[model samples]
Target: MTKHNNLQSISVRIAVKTPAVSRALEEIVSTLDGFEQQLDEKATQTDVLVLEVGDNPAKEFETVRALLEDGVVNQVFLTSAKTTTDILLPALRTGAKQFFQQPLVFQEVQQAFVDIHKERIAGEGIAVEKVSIKPGKMVSVLGAKGGVGTTTVAVNLAVSLNRLYPEKTIALVDMNRVLGEVTVFLDLQTEFNWDELVKNISRLDPAYLAKALIQSAPGLYVMPAPNSIESGSQVSSQVMKQVLETTKNSFDFVIVDAGTQVGASAFRIFSSSDTIALITTLSLPCIINVKRLLGTMRLLGSIPMNNINIIANRFEKKSAISLEDTEKMTGHSVYSTLPNDYQKTLEAINTGKPLVDVAKNSQLVKSLNKLAESLIVKEEPVVKRKSWFW
Candidate 1:
């Protein structure tokens, strides 16, 4: 396939509000690569598709909503006649990258074509493999014991990522349905829970996924557990995998709050995460479990030795084990030790607000910020393989 001047190549569906708009946009987009047709969505691989949805604004909105929900269309071009601010807002609200108020601009048309050409050129220049995560990074945060404050770390860490990477997407998944109060901690309304999402698992798209996770910030999304346990999802590893795979494609990061019983789905998520943060304190048995989990992961090759980082939560200077001693005992460096700010953390928890918002500069919040930075900016360094003889 000699790739050039063919928008149908990439499969990014560009939908317009009307038939005329669709026809007009097609005339413009066909000149570019990877732009596919709305009809061909199922038949062909549409990296980007252009559609003129003027045929039915309401239906168009619904269709567009579903597309964005499913993370199908990479980029969108909105066109309407004397369009109201209301018309364009919905598309933009759902993350349509570029919108056109007036009919196809000769300059924008030219520019859009130019941009596509440049992307193709740049594609050749870079040798990076496309690592596609549906919504974001799915980092499974589980507790060693019941009261290890796993949800606390998960929610704040997610909030931190939202603040730090306001440009990228991050999701905090409360896997602990019964007791998982991530929503309560963040003070977000638990109107829609895991069941609603699981119901639409087949069509779990970006637009839908975005709505599923409460938008705590522009970049961060939170998928809280159900309010009442009367009829929630019996989420298995497969279900979690499907949701996670869809999330990986749409967002840059996904933080999972694994409440207890790291079995089935929980185990799978941890095994395949970019990073696995084991939140444990100085309790001897908890520490032992953390160590044992690490050893088990290494033995099973479920998690690489390097990707596992231990986080000592509610830490204080007066702790019995020094940082060095903790490291020695665990045989792993303590990534970040979050201080025990009882009043501060509790207040934030009670109010359902992030410490960053309530107690912004607190030591514990600062430590979480540092940890967030470490995850976002730090890249894996090359390591040498151990020789058999050694």
Candidate 2:
């Protein structure tokens, strides 16, 4: 890709047979600047593809697939009146980057065009240098049960890590498929989420990942989960693994909030994580669930006991379930204990800020810092191995 110093417009190719779809594209193109429409035959020369589903949806999908497979087009925008799963699923499987229903919204199409423009500009400046990328440490935070403060630990831990290592890049991923609340905790208003990335997982790279991330802090980026339940279910294990692999390559620390529900995607993330923080409290039910979770992990053998860090959240000195008993039951030592500071924790949650920022002197913040330090220490060995052994 060559950069044009006086580039005025982005070239777009439309291949829709549907009259309504063609009109929609024409209207969208007319309203947007730096965008020029091209004939369908110019697919090889255009920067975007607006392919509308016709009488034969399967054939249209195949056309899209072939264009992508042959590298003739990098961006494909699909339009369809039949938005049923039968049609949409196959269309997406064919590597269609975006979908638009009949009577396409200008705003949606405009955003897609903007993304293409940004991607093109970024691609033009790519150098041929072979930069070494050390795979980052992935830490998956799993809750024994719901309402166990799993998100709290994950969010604060990520913030603390970012603070501790000001020069390193840190990302926090909310892997909770159905009910992820990481964005709410951080008070981030994100226009794009994991769903958008999953739709184009095949095109994922450092640049694309960087665009998808929402900067919650100066050095901390967050990939929030989908807002709707339907979109959440679409996040397959394959997509999760791809996202984690890409993120691990791009950042120094990747903290994932893997909510209580354990599914195929959760298992894939668990297997990839350098440390799996199994969060629990002193409650008996929580301990039992933790024990069961450990048994399941042991059975799978993907996550070793050593890598599994048992975290006791909301720890109280006078709790009936002592730390020793909790350890014996869970068959793993408590890696860290967070004091029960209810008011402080609630304040942070309500304010949509990390505990480290809201309650700097809180014991919870100190515990999270300790956790971050441990993770940094663990990463030192990997860096040494990469430098010396590799």
Candidate 3:
């Protein structure tokens, strides 16, 4: 019921048989920020309950599960001197968020309490009703073939959105399993990657997600690909679906650099996206690939035809194939075009900066910015009603 530093106070109830573990838990809970110890033995409900195993371990586990299922306690932490599989597995299955041995480790207890505090804080944010903010929009950029500037468009568009809408939350995700260039494009050094999200799919709450994403200089949050092929291989389409679903509620816009990947996984990405920025050049092979990809999407019948937006990268008037010709070949009109600034784009990549930052006045940056603007949905203004007194 009390508040500490603007955070609601967390009430902790400790029920431990061991004298040493009881004392340690008391100390740890006392030291935790925004946490208060509930000494009332008769209290049935609390924010967090720390329970130690008793002689009848099975009965105790049942009681703990019931308490959680009935919403009597928000979270439960179990402790036991026995580290056997029977004890540990039951404790985990009983819905305990953390477990400590009889001889508790101070640092581990402290870290567990810290994680709980973060989750509680994030939970408060979620409890508040959504007013002006709605679910986020996702835009996935994919190249018809290699070297079509897919990453370039994704990175610069995200940066431009961050610049244009400073208050809105933006996320840039690299969906490539190996050798993804999203971080290199933005010059970002990420501590976490999409692999973490897949491994901790059950913990895909706001608190965990915030920790897994790193914010770049432009204020856009980025989730890079795995560092190695093995880690990338562990990510599955179902897990990526969960990640995207969780992120949609947390940000205003999510930009994905879906580097040339095909199959069920790639299909999931394209289907989940609100707009699929299919990037290609005027080359014949690229056009043919585009036509094939379109047919694949059409056959799958997951994404709408209009949702696929064809973008011509490095467009030049003298190119072998014109935009109209390419459209006729692919059965889709060109949605947008980026001017060919080979030298400028190269310098931007070499410097690890977005085209917008490298040359704001250049045609490439202008085109990218315009592309970013088209994806944003403008909210209608609310009309004020006249007061009776007025």
Tens-digit lDDT track of model 3 for 1-390: 123477778899988988988999999888767899998878878999999997899999999999999999998989899866567656756777776765777776776777677667677774432334345789999999988988988999999998987766788999988788888987877556888667767867554565567778545888889888899876788889889877776777889999888768889988889899999999999999999999999998999989999999999999989999999999999999999999999999999988877798998888888999886655642222211000
Instruction: Mark the 10 consecutive residues where model 2 has the least summed lDDT.
Output: 381-390
How many residue pairs of model 3 clash at the backbone?
A: 0
A best-first ranking of the candidates according to their TM-score comes to: 3, 2, 1
Model 2 agreement with the true structure over 190-296: per-residue lDDT tens digits: 65678878888877866557656778877789998887889989777988799899889878789999999787788889999888999999999999999999899
RMSD of each: 10.0, 10.1, 11.0
TM-score of 1: 0.63
Work out the TM-score per prediction: 0.63, 0.68, 0.69
lDDT of 1 by residue, 256-324 (tens): 888765666666877767787788887787888877777777777767877777888888888887778
Kindly indicate the candidate among 1 and 3 with the higher TM-score: 3
Cα error, candidate 2, residue 97 (Å): 10
lDDT of each: 0.67, 0.80, 0.82
- Stretches of candidate 3 off by over 4 Å are 1-10, 13-35, 38-133, 379-390
Q: What lDDT score is found at residue 205 in candidate 2? A: 68
lDDT of 3: 0.82
